[model samples]
Target: MALSFLSHCLIGLCALSLFAWAEKECRYLPGDSGWPSIDDWSGLNDTVQGRLIATIPQASVCNSLPYGNYNSTACAELRASWTEAETYVTRPAEMMNPYYQNQSCDPFVTEKPCELGNYAVYSVNVTGQEDVLAAIRFAKEKNVRLVIKSTGHDYNGKSTGKGALSLWMHSLKTLQIIQAYESDTYSGPAVKIGPGIIAGEAYEALANVGYRIVGGECASVALAGGYTSGGGHSMLNTAYGMAADGALEWEIVTAQGEYLVATPQENADLYWALSGGGGGTYGVVLSMTTKIHPDGFISSGALQFTLAGAPNESSFWEAVRLFFEQMPSLVSDRNSLQLEIENNTFDVFGITLPDQNISAVQPLVAPYLEELTRLNISYTFTTNFSATYLDYFASIMGPLPYGPYPPTEIWNNRLVPRSVVLNSTANNLLIDAFKLAVADGTFLVGCNGINVADNEQRKHPDNAVFPAWRDAIASCSLTAFWDFDAALEVNLAVKETLVSVYTPAIEAATPGSGVYLNEIDPWYEGDWKQEMYGVNYHRLLDIKHKYDPDSLFYGHFAVGSDEFTVDGSGRLCKI
Candidate 1:
């Protein structure tokens, strides 16, 4: 805080302190003191009175992130806050929340791995918007950086900034149906949503009214940030485009401590930017008004494929080929499909509106199915009906946790096309890697989703987001789950194996293929700037100028890039 502000309000606080038996969370060093210094633990007693500290020590989650002296100073100052509070951990355990806390920390020291490179949160979980505002204001006044997190699903750990305060937004979820179009008002219905609502809540709310919105595939992903920030694709994308297209307006809290609204008509730049700009670019979103579709039950199903037990053996690779060829035929906006490959099985998912059917979809997808059958691939199809978005999202995306803590670990990811199966040459390469990775337990999880096409304003000139891929099909996500200590080696191994398997094929099949920034991989050998945003990068920079002229909202994925840092090797630097 400013000297004047500190002298005025914090003098008493500096003299007071709090003591609590050590919890896993307390072990985490705070990012900034929010005060100049502290004399003893008793000084902070009042601040942590009701707060429950964890008994276990948190594990470190990230392996590599640019770190330097600035980080050291931040941690040192933050630790001083507890010193003034006279707080000490009497019983040091291993960790806190399983979903949010790092599961793998070194046993010797309670200090977070932030010293290595990664955010070790100060305090998290504010009561509400007011609490949120207070935290932001205090951080700014204190010259402390911050990271905003709702569900903490960010693979890069961007949800938590190193040596900073994390404003956990999960409790902020409040879904209100502001306006349900009257009988005479329109051809469609729409509703207002809170910034914290998840895809499951909004989906069910709208679906109950007899309509649906293209929302998150994961039931637990936050609707406003996680879902809309990336072009939301689901079994519905073939029908509704993406979650952002349904959005009409947005309420955001910018970095400068100002609350503002962005819409297609007002603050158009910001509205466009958030649609698919990829998360963490501009400001924390408060709420959004999105259009809802006509209501009806949806029929979704899964088709399981198995290789012909050629004397107890079916060529899993050939079975996969037949599945890819089947993709083009199944492009109905009413239908969505995903193929998951694991060592044990090949799971084919097919979801469509109730009115659409397996029989109706057969012709569209028949050719590929025929190829699979020709290979003696055995298959079975199963499905059911759902009247609510919750039911549908649950059936489709399944339940990925939206957690209580800002993420403690770093997980890397990539987005790729089905070009791996486009031809014989590529197929051969992909099949080999798939077999090896699965056998070695390297390719743990593989999931795919459809992308919205260009027709629904996806090509809006103002938005420099998702690169345009005409008639684009799907994005395969290669991911790994590991502890902080194991994260570095595991994440890298999965990434390298995935790239090694596909890069050659992607190059041979679709040279200069576009990339999706939302599914970014730092090492992917593609034109990142061009493939990620296309021509939108320039216009977005321009738009960022208008909406956030002073660049107060620069920490997240803001528009302008020039102001950020760079190192001697020509690598862009991170704060």
Candidate 2:
């Protein structure tokens, strides 16, 4: 009886120890105590299949000892190439967040020395679910903040955290095509992609098998990560739907270290939450299964007219105004339209009539052509009908935006409903706002909506993609940029200009509508709960608490993010 009592007492003590460990907040860096020792981290690295890498700032590649295998000449080339998209995307620590690098060091400034700031001290170069699970378990048990990253393509600063452990999911590149995916909710063709698989790669692979999937416009974007979870928009969206709408299932590692498959019938709540709840807030997803469509032809093209040569600047604005009025009909006809205006240049490009040929597309575009001629604006309009989606992407879509340089920029978005676009006064207000943004050198872009019609044939779970998207006919965004050498105050002024110029205009134009959460202004000050998620914020919050009660995962502007604030020093502090 005495021996048995002693054993029970030891078990109780171990449980108490675990509880206490979970309760205490772990501090590192500036903190004098509570940081994990080298041995503790080494043990964790071992458990994760030896994938942990202490983050080294990319800027250090040139200045570090022995040049890390590069000579002075090679270092110079690397320094110049550091500004390219691949340079940052390939590294675990380097990313799009200017604040992560403290906005002090950049490859643009040849004279200034670079140093790391606010970047995670260590990153797990995750290749599988085991690494993610172990990292989640360690972060929760030690009460250390955790950041999840895949390809470092996140526009918002969600993938970076100060003095934290990061799970770099970029190395987890795996893809498989299921000729026939059978499920109670969905029974069709599907593609299972690891967290690291990019949108372009997925498109190429799917096209090879006579299938195509809805994914992001950017080729470099990670489809299985934030893109799908945040309601991915695509050129194919007009004919199909948002990327999240095609999602059939996800395999994720929860905060409790449980690796579970979430589907419509199993872990239904998690499935719903993750579908479009905004990534980095739910569990770390290992793989995502997305519905694929049969490969088909897409009638796509671009038309550009110089605003400078127009009779007056108002003439260009008039063209844009007329375009907005026709958006609903164009969207209904399965046309994905895009408008980009900067300075004296105006460009319109997109795929129209996904199932129709170029001959059928000519009549649809004839109206816009007539309008341009009547306005005395000579425009260059070129249309091509590709045999497959891959041809369309490679020839038309991929080359549209050009290279991925100019890594830093200020951007914001608004979803304009069809009703508002049809309203004359509201439409003019949006036009005036666009003009103002252009005057401030902000690049303007707009896309016609994809979820114009619901397909009753395809069954899926409900997600948190702003319900405004359902009624909206178009999504518009404004972007302002500066070179790496631009002053901090200049960037701040650009953000303020965007806020002062576009925010109220969008509000006046579409009173009840909201912005796309994924592309929303990082500095957006409105009621995010209502704007980003519409009526779904409350349910998403509940799901967040259910899975991450301690708030281990946090994406910027995500549900339950109000509990924490990023301080001036770039530290994420509990409210």
Candidate 3:
């Protein structure tokens, strides 16, 4: 009876896979193309499902609407040019890629400013690998722009675009517990991740096998594309490395529309690039294969803090800094800890220590406790509790509410060096700055630090679409939640340290530095060639020109942007 039931389920899955593999039938024969059989000059006018799918602009109706970025006349002109073969149609690829301009709200404090472009770009719901291959081929043949989006977590708007047709890969998430065809005792079962996989889901999937992939520490961040593409950071990073380091293989849809599998043995250059080259510098990533670690070590809990009611603020900052300094020795490679500061009035810090046992954490944090007590500061730190990935994730983050939950609105981020907090004077200034923000009743803070050593342990993946970081230890982001009116001013004030330190480091470095592609500011523009990509830029360009001669893919950090690069005067230009 059991065998029969299992067989029945297998048959059902086969049928489902078949249905998903079918493609939209083409009604017209594209000239010199293998799609349809017929060939004739007049056939150009013939209507076909292929043409309908390929020719429609990702934002066909955007030009006719009242968008925040354009005046009525300019919008109309932009629309008119798309329907014709004028200068606008000939314009450099990058200009028309965004679903909505990412930087549109940079100078504004709107509630939606935390979000980037909408689902206004491509409207694709692809199911199989063939669909991705076809999308790539179709864009190449039709002279339409192309970009891929999975979770749309990208901050600089690297996912969807207007001139660009969307190749949505989020449907590819197929979580599985499969031991590779050949494996030894050490190999263990691997988690099969799809392009749309998020850290939250991957954790759940791996939990089934008593294991978890060291990916996506951010609850809402996607693991396969967005986070991995930008060298994803996580609570486990202090012990492991960045997310890219764990990637074993990837099924990528290239510029030439070929669906290729990249691994250490095949397409090695692409393998290197995607690990951390930053997004939009290479082909659209389909899915990744990553490392699976033994699960059940996660220690999750939240602690709250308040300065207004507390007797001392300086003591609080010192204790916090001191705790981080001691954090390295207390935890090993298997543990994870995330600290979230809610506000000066009250702060909730969540710690997920995946490497150490629960009993060990209390002892490790004891020194800070004593110091806090000595300074006459009142505080509460939870006893570490062992929990399953699913339970921990659910309890810690809660459910996603309607219209995108506003509380965990830490939508985007950039990696700041620990030096900024530990070594640089920035740490000293940061305490006062955070204190001031809280004193003024304007700041609610959540800080997440991922130990990224495991991510950079091996040679970094230097291709595909991510930036490379050198032996990076952690990625910290500060999110300030505020009322609609106060959001802009508050964020600007919080960003002062970033503007003064991290931003200048990037531009001032003989070569600039790079933040995660998923966390860049829309208003942030730069050559970024050396800083973001290091040595991978030139190689990525060569691949871009080879497979995308007409340069059809141009959304969310389009490649070959030579024509639209920012000039010496910060003027937007066409090369």
The 0-to-1 C-alpha lDDT of every candidate, in the order given, reads: 0.52, 0.75, 0.50
- Give the 10-residue window scoring lowest on summed lDDT in candidate 2: 62-71
**Candidate 2 local lDDT, residue 165:** 88
lDDT (Cα, tens digit) per residue for candidate 2, span 57-110: 766544533224324675677667655556766788777755345554455443
Please provide TM-scores, in order, for all candidate models, with all chains considered together. Answer: 0.71, 0.90, 0.68
Please give, for residues 1-575, the per-residue lDDT of candidate 1 as tens digits.
59988796666665453222111112123432333233322222234342212222222222122222224443444333221111111111211122223323332223443341234334444444455566556555444445666655554345544344555565556766645543321234567776556666666666666667776555555777755776666567666666666676778777666677887667777888887776666777777777776666666667776544322345566666556554644654556666667766778765465455435544555576666567666677676676654565666555423212122222223343545445666556555545555665445335454545555433333333465533456655544443433544564665565566644444444444565554444445555556666677777777666655544333323346446543332222333
Give the lDDT ranking, best first: 2, 1, 3
Total clashes, candidate 3? 42
After best superposition, candidate 3 residue 366: deviation in angstroms? Answer: 0.8
Stronger candidate by lDDT (1 vs 2): 2
How many pairs of residues collide in each model? Answer: 36, 0, 42
Q: For model 1, give the RMSD to the true fold.
A: 11.3
Candidate RMSDs in Å, in order, are: 11.3, 6.3, 16.2
TM-score of 3: 0.68
Which runs in model 2 stand beyond 4 Å of their true positions?
Answer: 1-27, 62-75, 109-113, 399-406, 446-461
Choose 1 or 3, whichever is better by TM-score: 1
lDDT for 53 (candidate 2): 90
